[model samples]
Target: LHTGCIPPIVHRDIKTTNILLDQNFQAKLADFGLSRSFPTGNETHVSTVVAGTPGYLDPEYYRTNWLTEKSDIYSFGIVLLEIITNQPIIQQSREKPHIVEWVSFMIRKGDIRNIMDPNLHQNYDIGSVWKATEIAMSCVSPSSIGRPNMSRVANDLKECLISENSRTGESRDMESKSMEFSMGIYTEVIPKAR
Candidate 1:
C-alpha cells in the first residue's frame, strides 16, 4: 500500500476523508489533486505551492514552499494520532487546545494517560497504547528529519502488533499449563536403572 519514486513524490494533500475504507475496512488512499511528481536525484527539497488540508498540512512546507516526502509523513502522523486518540484534529473547547497541541503538551509533560480516550479504558493494552502514541508523536515532530519514513512507521506498527500477539499467546499457554498442573494431569517421570 506504499509507492516510492525517484527523488520521491510529494502527496501534498493527505487527509482522513481522502483515505477510503471498503466494506471489509481496507484503506485506500485517494484524491491526489495537489500531488506533484519530483525527479529523483540529490536534492534536499523542492519548492511548490501550498496545497493540502488545513490540519494535515506541514508547517515547514507552508513556510518555505519546499516540498519533500516528509510533508506526507507529517500529515500521516496526524492521521495516526487521530486513530489512536479517537479525537478529531480540531476541537472547539475554549479551555482546551487543538488535538495536536494538546497531545504535544501532554507528551512534553510525560503524561500520556491524560491524552488517552477514556472509552478505551480496560479494553486496550497499556503498553501497546503508549507505544503507538509515542510513534505518532515522533511522526509529527517539528523537525522533519526526526520523523521516520512511511516504511519504518509501517514496520514499527507491524512489530508492535506481532509482539502483542505473542504476549497474548504466551499468557494463554501459561494459563493452560497451570490448569493442567492443578488438575494433576502431568506426572513427573522417575528414571529407572540406567
Candidate 2:
C-alpha cells in the first residue's frame, strides 16, 4: 500500500477481513470498491460522506467528515491492537466495548500485561510488545492531527521486529552461512553433467 499506489489511495474500508493471507502467509489488502484516491497537490482531505466499517471507522471522519490520511492511520491503530491481543474490535460484553478504549485504559494504568492475549504466554519480547502498543496508542489519539503518518508506523514496526529478533540472539549472519553451506554441499554431490 505504501509503495504500489500513485498519490496513494485510501481503502476507505480497512478491516481484518479485508486483509487476506496467501498460502505463504503474506498478507494482501482486498476489497477496493470504497477506496478513494488521496487528494492531489495542495488538497488535503476530500470532503466526502463517511464510509467505512463500524468498529474500525475514524471518529474524526465520522464527526466533521474531513477525510485525511490520518483517518486511515486511526483505523490502522485498531488493526495493530488486533494483532497484539487477538481480540475483536468491539468487545460487546465489556463496559468498554471498543478495543481501542480498552487498550487505552490498560495503557494509561501501566497494566500492559493485562491487555495482552493470554495465549501468547511469554513467547514474545515484552519490550517490543510495549513499543508497538505505544505506537498504536499514538495512532488513535482523538485529534486526527495527533496521529503519526503511515511511514512512521511502518518504520517503528520494523524496529520492533528487529528488537525482538535481537532479544532472541538470532543473527542474520548465521542464516546466510547456513544457506551458503547447504549450497556448497549440494553442488559437490551433483557434479557437472558436461
Off by over 4 Å in 2: 2-4, 171-194
How close to the true structure is residue 137 of candidate 1, measured as C-alpha lDDT?
77
Best by TM-score: 2
So what's the TM-score on candidate 2? Answer: 0.83
lDDT of 2 by residue, 1-194 (tens): 53246887887787788889888565778999988887557877889999999988999999999888888889889888998888999878976789998998787788877787889886878778888888888888899889987767766665677677788887654333212222111112222111
Give the per-residue lDDT digits (tens) of candidate 1, residues 7-53. 45777888888889888565778987778887666777887788898
Q: Which stretches of candidate 1 lie over 4 Å from their true place?
A: 1-3, 94-96, 167-194
The lowest-lDDT stretch of 10 consecutive residues in candidate 1 is 177-186
TM-score of each: 0.78, 0.83
> Local error of candidate 2 at 133, Å?
0.4
